[model samples]
Target: MRLDERIVPYLHMAGLYHLVRLNETWFRSDESLVSAFMERWRPETHMFHMPFGKCTITLQDMAYQLGLPIDGNYVSGCLMDFERYIKGGHPAWMRFEELLGVLPLANCIDKFTVKCSWMQETFGKLPHGVNDATVKRYARAYTMMLLGTQLFGDKFGTCLHIR
Candidate 1:
């Protein structure tokens, strides 16, 4: 089977996991996994995070500081490898930094199942097959994958987590 076709099952799983934990806050007020990941990549590129108030810090806050829409859903940057991609085109256009927050790998099963499922769901929901007006109205939702951060994990080890 083609790679895209094979990825569906995992994406479905990710979607399921996402649904199960829709209200769960996965970040902390201090240095966290997501922060660490951002710090690791930020210095390597043009991205930078601005400081904010509140003892509480989360992806949404970080996204806001980085210029991403705090209201949009996130997908794994790893999905860029797929042949089919929807470039965001809208009022709440998803920014490159918005996708910087990737789905975490809890275990091998979580990596291939939960995370992939979420990415698949997000991809399917991307704006497509619409009229010109609709397209123009939602330009930000149709972001091109030409420029995106790629998520990678250790290939030689079986630790499961990307870090």
Candidate 2:
């Protein structure tokens, strides 16, 4: 299947570079309104607006949790398909596109992949437990957390500095 045709997982989505890039836009605008809510609303969990759901180990958090090497150059994008995913449709996705304004995403995304080799080699499954990505999404949170946090401090510098 084409890469974009496959839903990109948070596993590969929340790279430091990707998050930082996103936050660069997010924090400066009204998007910041969600920060306080995001932090306290559910607390360190993957979230979707409809069905009132949450995934404790959303793929984005897993990268940091698993101590996966962060690829600063890594390019990640959530496929801009929301009407089907959101029952009533929340504006976060649309707002996000607005926050981004515009970019050379088409040029960049074609070259991207889940940067963590171990994540792919070991996890070997698509994202789950949140959104349409699948249901086991939250299943690996605890185990991956235990594994990643143990090494995060030690490997953090490397992950951040690597590119």
Name model 2 segments beyond 4 Å from true: 1-33, 43-51, 57-163
Model 2: per-residue Cα lDDT over 67-113, one tens digit each: 45654665333445433344356444343234222222332222211
TM-scores, all models, native as reference: 0.18, 0.17
> In terms of TM-score, how similar is model 2 to the real structure?
0.17
Q: What is the lDDT of every predicted structure here?
A: 0.32, 0.33
| Candidate 1 Cα misplacement greater than 4 A, ranges | 1-61, 77-81, 84-163
Scored by Cα lDDT, where does model 2 land? Answer: 0.33
